[model samples]
Target: MTQAIDRVRQALLQAGHPDTIAMFAEGTHTAAEAAASVGCSIAQIAKSIIFRSGETPILVVASGVNRIDRAKVGAALGRKVERADPAWVEATTGFAVGGVAPVGHLAPALILIDEDLLALDPVWAAAGSPSHAFRTTPADLVRVTGGSVANVKA
Candidate 1:
Protein backbone atom coordinates (compact mmCIF):
# COMPACT_ATOMS: atom_id res chain seq x y z
CA MET A 1 0.00 0.00 0.00
CA THR A 2 2.72 2.40 0.95
CA GLN A 3 4.76 1.59 -2.13
CA ALA A 4 1.82 2.19 -4.40
CA ILE A 5 1.11 5.53 -2.83
CA ASP A 6 4.78 6.46 -3.01
CA ARG A 7 5.02 5.60 -6.68
CA VAL A 8 1.93 7.65 -7.41
CA ARG A 9 3.23 10.59 -5.42
CA GLN A 10 6.58 10.55 -7.20
CA ALA A 11 4.92 10.33 -10.56
CA LEU A 12 2.63 13.24 -9.73
CA LEU A 13 5.53 15.37 -8.54
CA GLN A 14 7.57 14.57 -11.61
CA ALA A 15 4.71 15.49 -13.89
CA GLY A 16 3.72 18.62 -11.90
CA HIS A 17 0.30 17.18 -11.06
CA PRO A 18 0.87 16.20 -7.48
CA ASP A 19 -2.49 17.48 -6.40
CA THR A 20 -4.54 15.36 -8.80
CA ILE A 21 -2.67 12.09 -8.65
CA ALA A 22 -4.16 8.81 -7.45
CA MET A 23 -3.02 5.21 -7.96
CA PHE A 24 -4.34 1.68 -7.59
CA ALA A 25 -3.35 -1.70 -8.97
CA GLU A 26 -5.71 -3.28 -11.48
CA GLY A 27 -3.85 -6.55 -11.89
CA THR A 28 -4.14 -6.11 -15.64
CA HIS A 29 -3.26 -3.63 -18.39
CA THR A 30 -6.29 -3.46 -20.64
CA ALA A 31 -8.80 -0.61 -20.39
CA ALA A 32 -11.58 -3.09 -19.62
CA GLU A 33 -9.58 -4.57 -16.83
CA ALA A 34 -8.83 -1.15 -15.41
CA ALA A 35 -12.44 -0.09 -15.51
CA ALA A 36 -13.49 -3.27 -13.75
CA SER A 37 -10.91 -2.77 -11.07
CA VAL A 38 -11.91 0.83 -10.56
CA GLY A 39 -15.65 0.05 -10.66
CA CYS A 40 -16.44 2.23 -13.69
CA SER A 41 -17.71 1.79 -17.19
CA ILE A 42 -15.11 1.16 -19.86
CA ALA A 43 -16.21 4.32 -21.62
CA GLN A 44 -15.27 6.30 -18.56
CA ILE A 45 -11.62 5.51 -19.15
CA ALA A 46 -9.61 8.17 -20.94
CA LYS A 47 -7.00 6.70 -23.20
CA SER A 48 -3.92 8.85 -23.53
CA ILE A 49 -2.44 8.94 -26.98
CA ILE A 50 0.76 10.53 -28.28
CA PHE A 51 0.97 11.56 -31.89
CA ARG A 52 3.71 13.27 -33.87
CA SER A 53 3.30 16.23 -36.17
CA GLY A 54 6.70 16.40 -37.78
CA GLU A 55 9.05 16.98 -34.85
CA THR A 56 6.36 18.20 -32.47
CA PRO A 57 4.51 15.78 -30.20
CA ILE A 58 0.87 16.16 -29.23
CA LEU A 59 -1.02 14.27 -26.57
CA VAL A 60 -4.66 13.37 -26.87
CA VAL A 61 -6.83 12.22 -23.98
CA ALA A 62 -9.58 10.38 -25.77
CA SER A 63 -12.56 8.30 -24.71
CA GLY A 64 -11.95 4.57 -24.50
CA VAL A 65 -14.69 3.71 -26.98
CA ASN A 66 -13.66 6.20 -29.69
CA ARG A 67 -10.96 6.10 -32.31
CA ILE A 68 -9.19 9.32 -33.19
CA ASP A 69 -9.77 10.40 -36.74
CA ARG A 70 -6.33 11.23 -38.14
CA ALA A 71 -7.69 13.84 -40.55
CA LYS A 72 -9.44 15.66 -37.76
CA VAL A 73 -6.33 15.57 -35.60
CA GLY A 74 -4.21 16.92 -38.44
CA ALA A 75 -6.71 19.67 -39.11
CA ALA A 76 -6.84 20.64 -35.45
CA LEU A 77 -3.07 20.66 -34.98
CA GLY A 78 -2.47 22.29 -38.36
CA ARG A 79 0.11 19.63 -39.14
CA LYS A 80 0.35 16.05 -40.32
CA VAL A 81 -0.44 13.88 -37.35
CA GLU A 82 1.13 10.46 -37.13
CA ARG A 83 0.67 7.92 -34.39
CA ALA A 84 3.86 7.92 -32.41
CA ASP A 85 5.58 4.66 -31.47
CA PRO A 86 6.16 3.47 -27.91
CA ALA A 87 9.66 4.95 -27.80
CA TRP A 88 8.39 8.39 -28.74
CA VAL A 89 5.56 8.12 -26.23
CA GLU A 90 7.96 7.20 -23.45
CA ALA A 91 10.47 9.85 -24.44
CA THR A 92 7.85 12.55 -24.56
CA THR A 93 5.59 11.56 -21.66
CA GLY A 94 8.05 9.81 -19.31
CA PHE A 95 5.29 7.26 -18.65
CA ALA A 96 4.88 3.98 -20.47
CA VAL A 97 2.41 3.90 -23.33
CA GLY A 98 -0.29 2.19 -21.26
CA GLY A 99 0.12 4.44 -18.23
CA VAL A 100 0.33 7.94 -19.63
CA ALA A 101 -1.86 10.18 -17.51
CA PRO A 102 -3.68 13.27 -18.73
CA VAL A 103 -1.93 15.77 -16.48
CA GLY A 104 1.38 14.18 -15.49
CA HIS A 105 3.93 13.90 -18.26
CA LEU A 106 7.71 14.07 -18.42
CA ALA A 107 7.51 17.11 -20.63
CA PRO A 108 4.80 19.54 -21.56
CA ALA A 109 2.82 18.19 -24.47
CA LEU A 110 0.20 19.96 -26.56
CA ILE A 111 -2.71 18.27 -24.79
CA LEU A 112 -6.13 17.80 -26.33
CA ILE A 113 -9.19 16.23 -24.75
CA ASP A 114 -11.95 14.51 -26.67
CA GLU A 115 -15.12 16.57 -26.25
CA ASP A 116 -17.15 13.41 -25.73
CA LEU A 117 -15.29 12.67 -22.55
CA LEU A 118 -16.70 15.77 -20.92
CA ALA A 119 -20.12 14.15 -20.95
CA LEU A 120 -19.08 11.47 -18.51
CA ASP A 121 -19.67 12.12 -14.84
CA PRO A 122 -16.45 10.68 -13.43
CA VAL A 123 -13.66 9.83 -15.83
CA TRP A 124 -10.81 7.43 -15.23
CA ALA A 125 -7.22 8.27 -16.17
CA ALA A 126 -3.92 6.43 -15.97
CA ALA A 127 -1.66 7.05 -12.99
CA GLY A 128 1.88 6.56 -14.31
CA SER A 129 1.64 2.81 -13.88
CA PRO A 130 0.24 0.32 -16.30
CA SER A 131 -1.79 -1.44 -13.64
CA HIS A 132 -3.08 1.67 -11.96
CA ALA A 133 -5.64 4.46 -12.61
CA PHE A 134 -7.87 6.94 -10.81
CA ARG A 135 -11.23 8.72 -11.03
CA THR A 136 -11.82 12.44 -11.46
CA THR A 137 -14.31 14.80 -13.01
CA PRO A 138 -13.78 15.87 -16.61
CA ALA A 139 -13.83 19.55 -15.68
CA ASP A 140 -11.01 19.06 -13.21
CA LEU A 141 -8.99 17.11 -15.73
CA VAL A 142 -9.43 19.84 -18.32
CA ARG A 143 -8.37 22.51 -15.87
CA VAL A 144 -5.40 20.58 -14.50
CA THR A 145 -4.11 19.46 -17.87
CA GLY A 146 -4.75 22.85 -19.44
CA GLY A 147 -6.26 20.90 -22.25
CA SER A 148 -8.62 22.30 -24.81
CA VAL A 149 -11.70 20.14 -25.17
CA ALA A 150 -12.27 19.40 -28.84
CA ASN A 151 -13.72 16.91 -31.28
CA VAL A 152 -10.91 14.38 -31.49
CA LYS A 153 -12.63 11.86 -33.67
CA ALA A 154 -15.46 11.14 -36.07
Candidate 2:
Protein backbone atom coordinates (compact mmCIF):
# COMPACT_ATOMS: atom_id res chain seq x y z
CA MET A 1 0.00 0.00 0.00
CA THR A 2 1.14 3.55 -0.53
CA GLN A 3 2.12 5.71 2.43
CA ALA A 4 -1.08 7.69 2.08
CA ILE A 5 -3.18 4.53 2.15
CA ASP A 6 -1.21 3.24 5.10
CA ARG A 7 -1.87 6.38 7.07
CA VAL A 8 -5.59 6.04 6.37
CA ARG A 9 -5.55 2.39 7.43
CA GLN A 10 -3.78 3.28 10.63
CA ALA A 11 -6.25 6.00 11.35
CA LEU A 12 -9.19 3.70 10.77
CA LEU A 13 -7.75 0.99 12.93
CA GLN A 14 -6.97 3.44 15.71
CA ALA A 15 -10.56 4.65 15.54
CA GLY A 16 -11.79 1.03 15.90
CA HIS A 17 -13.32 1.03 12.42
CA PRO A 18 -14.05 -2.51 11.24
CA ASP A 19 -13.61 -2.29 7.49
CA THR A 20 -10.31 -2.59 5.64
CA ILE A 21 -9.27 -0.34 2.80
CA ALA A 22 -9.80 -1.63 -0.76
CA MET A 23 -7.60 -0.52 -3.61
CA PHE A 24 -8.94 -0.49 -7.15
CA ALA A 25 -6.69 -0.65 -10.17
CA GLU A 26 -9.10 1.50 -12.15
CA GLY A 27 -9.19 4.16 -9.43
CA THR A 28 -12.01 5.77 -7.47
CA HIS A 29 -11.26 9.38 -8.24
CA THR A 30 -14.86 10.48 -8.74
CA ALA A 31 -18.10 9.73 -6.95
CA ALA A 32 -19.57 8.05 -10.03
CA GLU A 33 -16.52 5.85 -10.44
CA ALA A 34 -16.49 4.92 -6.77
CA ALA A 35 -20.18 4.02 -6.70
CA ALA A 36 -19.81 1.93 -9.85
CA SER A 37 -16.79 0.12 -8.45
CA VAL A 38 -18.47 -0.56 -5.11
CA GLY A 39 -21.84 -1.51 -6.63
CA CYS A 40 -23.70 1.13 -4.68
CA SER A 41 -25.92 4.14 -5.29
CA ILE A 42 -24.22 7.46 -5.81
CA ALA A 43 -25.68 8.70 -2.56
CA GLN A 44 -23.82 6.04 -0.64
CA ILE A 45 -20.50 7.63 -1.49
CA ALA A 46 -19.37 10.12 1.09
CA LYS A 47 -17.36 12.71 -0.83
CA SER A 48 -15.11 14.79 1.37
CA ILE A 49 -14.98 18.43 0.26
CA ILE A 50 -12.45 20.86 1.63
CA PHE A 51 -12.99 24.54 2.31
CA ARG A 52 -11.21 27.37 4.04
CA SER A 53 -12.57 29.68 6.71
CA GLY A 54 -9.69 32.11 6.67
CA GLU A 55 -6.65 30.01 7.64
CA THR A 56 -8.67 27.17 9.11
CA PRO A 57 -9.57 24.19 6.99
CA ILE A 58 -13.06 22.72 7.02
CA LEU A 59 -14.09 19.31 5.84
CA VAL A 60 -17.58 18.58 4.58
CA VAL A 61 -18.44 14.93 4.02
CA ALA A 62 -21.55 15.03 1.93
CA SER A 63 -23.57 12.46 0.03
CA GLY A 64 -22.45 12.07 -3.56
CA VAL A 65 -25.92 12.74 -4.95
CA ASN A 66 -26.08 16.14 -3.31
CA ARG A 67 -24.31 19.40 -3.89
CA ILE A 68 -23.08 21.29 -0.89
CA ASP A 69 -24.68 24.64 -0.13
CA ARG A 70 -21.85 27.00 0.75
CA ALA A 71 -24.30 29.41 2.28
CA LYS A 72 -25.51 26.84 4.76
CA VAL A 73 -21.94 25.94 5.54
CA GLY A 74 -21.08 29.55 6.13
CA ALA A 75 -24.11 29.90 8.37
CA ALA A 76 -23.00 26.94 10.41
CA LEU A 77 -19.47 28.23 10.82
CA GLY A 78 -20.70 31.76 11.35
CA ARG A 79 -18.18 32.91 8.74
CA LYS A 80 -17.69 32.95 5.03
CA VAL A 81 -16.01 29.91 3.47
CA GLU A 82 -14.17 29.48 0.22
CA ARG A 83 -13.01 26.42 -1.69
CA ALA A 84 -9.50 25.36 -0.84
CA ASP A 85 -7.01 25.12 -3.64
CA PRO A 86 -5.31 21.81 -4.40
CA ALA A 87 -2.11 22.75 -2.58
CA TRP A 88 -4.00 23.97 0.45
CA VAL A 89 -6.09 20.81 0.52
CA GLU A 90 -3.04 18.59 0.42
CA ALA A 91 -1.25 20.69 3.03
CA THR A 92 -4.20 20.65 5.37
CA THR A 93 -5.43 17.07 4.95
CA GLY A 94 -2.25 15.25 3.97
CA PHE A 95 -4.15 13.81 1.01
CA ALA A 96 -4.84 15.07 -2.47
CA VAL A 97 -8.19 16.57 -3.43
CA GLY A 98 -9.55 13.35 -4.92
CA GLY A 99 -8.48 11.19 -1.98
CA VAL A 100 -9.09 13.07 1.22
CA ALA A 101 -10.56 10.74 3.86
CA PRO A 102 -12.95 11.81 6.56
CA VAL A 103 -10.41 10.96 9.22
CA GLY A 104 -6.62 11.07 9.37
CA HIS A 105 -6.24 14.68 8.34
CA LEU A 106 -2.77 16.19 8.85
CA ALA A 107 -4.27 19.16 10.67
CA PRO A 108 -7.34 19.57 12.80
CA ALA A 109 -10.45 20.73 10.89
CA LEU A 110 -14.00 21.57 11.64
CA ILE A 111 -15.76 18.66 9.97
CA LEU A 112 -19.36 18.73 8.89
CA ILE A 113 -21.25 15.68 7.61
CA ASP A 114 -24.39 15.77 5.53
CA GLU A 115 -27.40 14.62 7.49
CA ASP A 116 -28.58 12.76 4.40
CA LEU A 117 -25.65 10.41 4.73
CA LEU A 118 -27.03 9.27 8.06
CA ALA A 119 -30.02 7.78 6.25
CA LEU A 120 -27.78 5.35 4.44
CA ASP A 121 -26.67 2.30 6.39
CA PRO A 122 -23.42 1.71 4.54
CA VAL A 123 -21.29 4.46 3.01
CA TRP A 124 -17.98 4.59 1.17
CA ALA A 125 -15.27 7.19 1.62
CA ALA A 126 -11.91 7.89 -0.03
CA ALA A 127 -8.97 6.29 1.78
CA GLY A 128 -6.13 8.74 1.22
CA SER A 129 -5.47 7.66 -2.37
CA PRO A 130 -7.48 7.91 -5.54
CA SER A 131 -7.45 4.14 -5.92
CA HIS A 132 -8.33 3.35 -2.29
CA ALA A 133 -11.59 3.36 -0.39
CA PHE A 134 -13.30 1.76 2.60
CA ARG A 135 -16.81 0.96 3.73
CA THR A 136 -18.14 2.85 6.70
CA THR A 137 -21.30 4.28 8.19
CA PRO A 138 -22.15 7.94 8.57
CA ALA A 139 -22.26 7.50 12.30
CA ASP A 140 -18.79 6.00 12.25
CA LEU A 141 -17.63 8.98 10.22
CA VAL A 142 -19.03 11.40 12.80
CA ARG A 143 -17.51 9.35 15.62
CA VAL A 144 -14.08 9.03 14.07
CA THR A 145 -13.86 12.61 12.91
CA GLY A 146 -15.82 14.21 15.72
CA GLY A 147 -17.95 15.98 13.14
CA SER A 148 -21.44 17.34 13.32
CA VAL A 149 -24.27 16.16 11.07
CA ALA A 150 -26.17 18.95 9.37
CA ASN A 151 -28.22 19.74 6.30
CA VAL A 152 -25.24 20.24 4.10
CA LYS A 153 -26.99 19.19 0.94
CA ALA A 154 -28.04 21.84 -1.54
TM-score top scorer: 2
Per-candidate TM-scores read 0.83, 0.96
Best by lDDT: 2
Q: What tens-digit string does per-residue lDDT give for candidate 2 at 1-154? A: 3777888888898989875688877788899989998889999999999999988998999999999999999888788999899999998789998899888888899989999999997999999988899999878988988898888778
Q: Model 1, stretches more than 4 Å misplaced?
A: 1-23
What TM-score would candidate 2 get against the native?
0.96
* Candidate 2 weakest lDDT stretch, 10 residues: 1-10
lDDT at position 106, candidate 2: 82
lDDT per prediction?
0.74, 0.89
RMSD of each: 3.4, 1.2
